[model samples]
Target: MSTEGRSAEPVSATSALESAGFVRLVARADGDGLAASGLIASALAELETPFQVTVGRTIAERSARVDPPTNEDDRTIVVGAADAAADTDDVIRLPATDRPATLEAVDLVREIGGTPDPVLALAGVVAGGSEPGAGESEWLLETAIERGLLEQRPGVAVPTSDPIDGVAHSTRLRAPWSGDLDATREALSDAVDGDSDALDADDHRAIGSLVALDAVGADEATDATAESIGRLLRPYATPDHAFATLGGFADVLEALARTEPGTGTALAMGHDVRETALEAWREHGRRAHAALSSASTGRYDGLFVVDVDDGPVETIATIVAASRSPEPVVLAIGHAEAALATREADSLGATVDGVARELAGAEPETEPAFEDGSEIGVEYDVGHRRSYLRYDPDLDNSTIIAAVREFR
Candidate 1:
């Protein structure tokens, strides 16, 4: 197969696989990337096609893991990493956008004359935090419900199977009862009856009222409190899988990817690693809750910075951005890596990726991590709403802080 002009035109995923001598699949380690990889891998198995899937967070890291195709017939499909298109022969380039990569993978599977798995797609939707009642997310959600891959019901949006555990681990709702098992159970006593598998509408309403009351007592901003309550009351998408709900599965994927990329990839590739994933999720929630509780926070002109000693930076950053802070952008920084997240339904008049690039450019030693395997660099996520920066001795936290202040 001639490789010239492949990047300029749109090539069907099916055509690339059929023509390639060997197929190398590179995916990011995040939830959307994992779901996309899993979806495509299943399709390849159905077609009896041999392939390899390499998962990593940054495009540079994932691309570096693959050797250049030895033969012209060999092709590589890069999923959830649009920037990788320039690196080599990308059979498919799904850019990071509001639309999750798993949806794009579903379309590709359909093009390949295979049925897309709705369960994997549902995981991706929840992981991507797709807006409900709008656009493709709504369509995919309806399809999942119709296919029985997901059951829609009125309930609290917490991901855990147990209501008490769910309330305790909830990052969106920061009540006095949060992170305290006894407090959480006491808070839910009136709303819950027996050990129910799921929460009913009345239970949800009661819990929402309590959370609202807590917010009011704490003197939270009216708009921020309302958003928190809305998120808490969103309808639950329960899945008939190892995990209880779609959000729970998404959390597992994220936790595993941050801590152990290989384990996350295994779980996403239809492996029976539910127990392992759940353990990781539990540990992750515990650490995140502790980090949030003890975080030493600083305020920048356009950023809310949370100093974390140890924890999942991305998860912490996302939580702070979505609920804990009113700033348009939030940064959670640790010793090794830092993650920057933008608030939902808001923007900083620029993409986080652009901001990261600018920051990298500000320092001569710092470079864009996705472009090369630099020890100190920045990587923007798929949605352009968040970015991660790998810290180096030269590019320390102080340097990043100063650069960000200058940029802002």
Candidate 2:
């Protein structure tokens, strides 16, 4: 309803205002009286409310004042929705973070009646698609629910479990080991692979994250984009693994897909990564064991794990060609080679792989389409992508970075 950045959750409109007792409404007006009137009518129709819509030929002629409320309890609390301002009679005013569901915030207040419950408030906002999650609205709301400020709806109630917030940035994000996304990702990888020493900067002065990003396999060539469950661990890593038995790798990848490391723009994808390994383990441990055991017992083809770095794309092409699996080979690369490796993976029809300590560039498209003057180059029989990149220690890191950037 409002794009003031106060729109509700990325989830569905249903989750944001899932309560039956809640009824949401919205209204807007601009210089064009006809357009404004149409929008009001549309909103009312969409919401299935009893309100009627009427349009006037001019600003003064268009409408009349609605009667004021009789009591304080009925007085409206006008919040600035995202970036807009409304009069006192208008119930909810959100600025930049307002959405149609933000109107549900009125319903939220009515539900809890000034109980200071973040959960109900968040639920109201989540009903729309506003807010950049400066705070975990859902968790904050759930916390409020735990505090007994709001009551959960029957059947519509959220779980009472303590779900993982995935990753959070403290004020000291760059202050060294502050538990920022980078450190969180590296911690997960380290915890999984038994390399807790990853990202060694315990102080995290620059990042101030609890997890040290440097301890992981980091290099200067690649930018320090902490990649965690949602850019939670290594600042630059793609979704590949986590600290515990991965229930589904997509959750980690899905979270990473939500936003870029530096820009924080939500990349369109399915589902949000909010739970930790322990919570997942408790929630679906039985299913995981059964699936893993089943996979292990199956007859599978050869598995080839390729680690590539700053080298010519031609070298990686050779390795992909040699892999036995019908499924393309996987390229696990370091941070410096990320850009080039991503290009190379695309050209080779392979997927990228990574943990928090490093960046892995992958894409399942190996067929390189050459330009008019492009040359078909492939190095001699190479055993692995990593070896080819390392074949020349004389190569400077900058060159590796450039190669990664231009690999595809």
Instruction: Give the TM-score of each candidate.
Output: 0.83, 0.21
lDDT of 1 by residue, 291-349 (tens): 77788888877778999988878888877776677687788888656777776654322
Off by over 4 Å in 2: 1-108, 111-188, 194-408
The residue-by-residue lDDT of candidate 2 on 281-352, one tens digit each, is 222322222222222111113222223332223222222322211233323232222211121212221211
Per-candidate local distance difference test = 0.66, 0.25
Consecutive 10-residue window with the lowest summed lDDT within model 1: 1-10
RMSD of each: 4.6, 20.9
Who wins the lDDT comparison? Answer: 1
State in Å the error of residue 19, model 1. 2.6
* Candidate 2 TM-score, true structure as reference: 0.21
